[model samples]
Target: MSAGLLILFYLGLSLGPLILAWAQELDPRTPWDELATGLGFLALAIILVEFLLLGRFRLVTGRVGSDVVMRSHQLLARAALVLAVLHPFFYISPRTPAPAWDVTRQSVVDQSWHALWPGIVAWLLLGGLVAMALAKEVSGLRYQHWRLLHGLGAAVIAGFGVLHALRAGRYSADPALAAVWLALLALALGALAYVYLIAPLLRLRRPWRVREVRHEADRTWVLTLTPDFRGRLPYRAGQFAWLNVGKPVVSLDENPFSIASAPSAGPEIEFLIKEQGDSTCRTGQIAPGTRAWLEAPHGHLIIDKHPDAAGIALVAGGVGLAPLMGILRELHATGDQRPTALIYGNRHAGQIAYGPELERLAREHGTELVHVLSEPPPGWTGETGLITPDLLRRHFGPPDRHGWLYVLCGPPPMLTMVEDTLIDMGIPAHRILSEQFVYD
Candidate 1:
């Protein structure tokens, strides 16, 4: 979907309940009471919508990119938490039985044990859930354990929140708003089931086996996988896949890695994984024939979608060169004649991956290859210092270079600087595509 449409869809889903509640034309309460109900409606809707954001649905992330979707998931979750936290406090209505004349029960807020218990439990769980997520990196918990806890916690909170709304909320008593809550709750649960249960079961049919594992650069290993099935995976050049190496179908051990080889490179796939994390640190120990499960291609840092561009500029740092390599390889295999440039930055000479292959591309593919090193070797001949705007100006400063497509994949700080520099240089925002690995 286009970005505007995706945002419109999200607003509709998040605000639809509130709009429906207002349309009920029920008896009016105090301004504070109505505001409290509005907050509750929005909070629950956003909470339920969180399920779809992290569900890895292609229809949602295909256009906006996984990074955008995941970031949205994190931000919206915090917004919902804030609204939920203040929802009850804003209610100034008296905590008493509804008078005989107040048929709509708008005169007082419900305070019965059954009505309050579910909301209290859900509210507390929501706080814990967000806290655990924010502390995931430092918690020392396995990625799989964190995922399970987060999914189950969200499901429980959604269930209880809906129950509380039905029992305690005056506007929520309307059958229209009640049905909306139930549907959202059902969808939230369904999303969890699809991610944890259905997707894994379906992946069993497309198994893969590790074909080769070899050292490439400093602390980086190149892994090659071959399908045990009939055909190759249909993926765009720069997309990523979730690989569950030596794990069960229902396992949460899967991790996303960008494809380092092009689809045109045949059935075998390659990934340049840097030893930095739990599974990645043990890359060298993985056997050549280990069983693996492959998920569908996920990412939007692709050049094929921008066929109108006059040139392709690939900017990468460290192991972030994985996806950019796939795009370059694809261009070479298809004999694309569009002008291409690669500005790769690393700490030193030893950190540059695929040295011979990149030089070969420069020689044969006529790619304008430039390497930036923060700490150069004794006989360094390439550019020295980080990839600054001054360095970028040397290559992309010309008016003719304004129409080139710039693809970036790197750490957050480097990406931010490069993107800003490119935009400032008059390259349109839509032409710059990027993806970073930052799940937490």
Candidate 2:
């Protein structure tokens, strides 16, 4: 589907609950009371939608890049947390027994312990959940442990929030609204089940095996995987997959890595992995032929999406060159004669991966390869500084180059600098594609 259609679908899912509640035509309460209920309804809806925005759904992330989808998930979670936190405080009505005339609790909040307990539990847990998420990096939690906690916590919050809505909410007592809540809750839970259970079960049928693990650069390894089954791993050049080596299909030990091998280069997928966390730092120890599992082909960095572009400009930093290498190799293999340029920046020459192939691309395929080093070697002849605005302007300043498709993968700071410079140089935002290596 198109971007516009995806946006329309999202807006519809988010606003549909509010519209249904308004259609109930119940007696109106004070503005504050209505505002409180409105915020609760909206927050619940947003929380439910957060499941799909976890960047695992291809239907959602395929059109917009996973980086954009994951970023949206983070922002929307915070937004829902704020709305949920303030929802109870907005009620002006007293928490007391409803008068005979207000049988539906239209003018009073439900004070019964049964109705309020779920809401109280959900409310407090929501705060803690958001807090833990915001502090994930500094919380000293392992990535897999944090992921499991995050998923289970979200599921509990959704369950309790729905229960509270059904029992304590005045509008939620309506059958249509109650059905909406149930459906939303089911979907939220279903998303969890799909990610944790169903997807892994399917992956069991088409497992991969570790074919090789060769050290590519300083503290980096080129890990190759070949399918244990029949066909090749179908993926775009610039996409990535969650790889689990020597682990069960349902294990959370997997980490995402960009595909460094070209799709045209056959089924054996390759990943240039840099030593980072516990799982990645031990890539060298993973024996060949170890059973591996891959959640294949996720990302929108592929060049095929922008065939109208006059040229391709790939900007990569350090090991972020993995995906760009795939794109370059595919272009070269397919004999795509689009004018291509690569601006690769690293701390030193030793940090560059696939250096010989990159040089070959420049010599044989007419790719304008510019190597920028922050700490160059003693006898380096290339640029020796950060990839700055001046560097971009020197290479892509011409009027015709503005139409080129610029794909960037790098650390956050370099991405920000290059993206800002590109926009300042009159490159349209739609023409520039980028994915940050680190989401956290």
lDDT of each: 0.92, 0.91
**What are the per-residue Cα lDDT tens digits for candidate 1 across 246-359?**
888788888899999999989899999998879999989999999998887899887988999999999999989999999999999999999999999999999999999999
Model 2 lDDT-worst window of ten:
102-111
Q: What is the alpha-carbon lDDT for the whole of candidate 1?
A: 0.92
Counting clashing residue pairs in each candidate, in order, gives 0, 0
- The residue-level lDDT of candidate 1 at 61 comes to 86
What's the lDDT of the predicted structure labeled candidate 2? 0.91
Clashes of 2: 0
Compute the lDDT of residue 281 as modeled in candidate 2. 93
TM-score of each prediction: 0.98, 0.98
lDDT of 1 at 13: 92
